[model samples]
Target: MAGPNAPWHQKKNHPVRRHFPFVLLFALLGLSALASAPAAALEFELGAGPVDEIDGDGTWIATASWLTGQRHPWELAVGMIGARTQAQGVDTGDVYFVSVSRRLTWKRWFVQGGIAFTDSDNEVLSNHWQFRTGLGYDFGRFSLSVAHLSNANTGGRNRGETFALLQVAF
Candidate 1:
């Protein structure tokens, strides 16, 4: 007997269980087809992850934006973000950002670099400015990004941070 949500191994032992790779391949192809045929210009995303070294140790973030220039070389986005730590008594901040990036496409791979400004909401930690750049790849419907953020004031005590993001745009 197995629970409703049990893993396949716990539910049954069968030869069909070995066909996962083929199932995944077909699913990916279906998603790619859907992604390439788009009907809207606005996209929304929400994600949560752990942020190392912060008292809030675990960070949860959300983003919403309007994207234009569909699949073009030059792209622009305007959005707001709420990033907070999960630790007790830690200050969580919400900021607004506007970014512009150019897509460099090579085969199925692409790289994008962008600059953004954040309106710091936490007075103690806010210098009101941060810069970001990302490297990504487009697999029809999915894009993976590795990005970094640095404070504008080098003379100040603010430390820079980096984030690795994997995005699915549909």
Candidate 2:
């Protein structure tokens, strides 16, 4: 009899990765929809880069937006994130976070900024507070965005991110 491991093709179909940011985005969106939200939106992000010469890493993040008024292009947003990286045969860095943001729009361009509080899995990697700023363009129900996140305690490292945003109204 052949054991399950005997053949390379015998492996079952399974998901190998847990996408936390996407999960959080959907959860936040569902909550916003149920609350009869106006101009509420959710965004998800993934990132990867070199932490050092010997290693590379990735992270996932999500954010939700709420519009305060119908007339002005002012809105407030909340975000959450989960990130992890391994180096030198050890899981040496991680970040779990929550944040708040405000956005203002004019014609096709918009400017936004936010502040975040992060908890690190490894205390040595703790940066505590992170700040972000961005510029975006709106095209119908979709948009494109670019942002930067910086922290004083992060050893002069900054995270640059780009996002493709899509919105659907019910």
Best-fitting candidate, scored by TM-score? 1
Instruction: Judging by lDDT against the true structure, name the best candidate.
Output: 1
Tell me the TM-score of model 2.
0.48
TM-score for all models, in order of appearance: 0.53, 0.48
**Residues 30-61, candidate 2, lDDT per residue (tens digit)?**
45543453435333333222222224544444
Which ten-residue region of model 2 has the weakest summed lDDT? 8-17
| lDDT per residue as tens, model 1, 120-168 | 5252234444555657666655566565555655435454445555555
Model 1 clashing residue pairs (backbone): 56-87
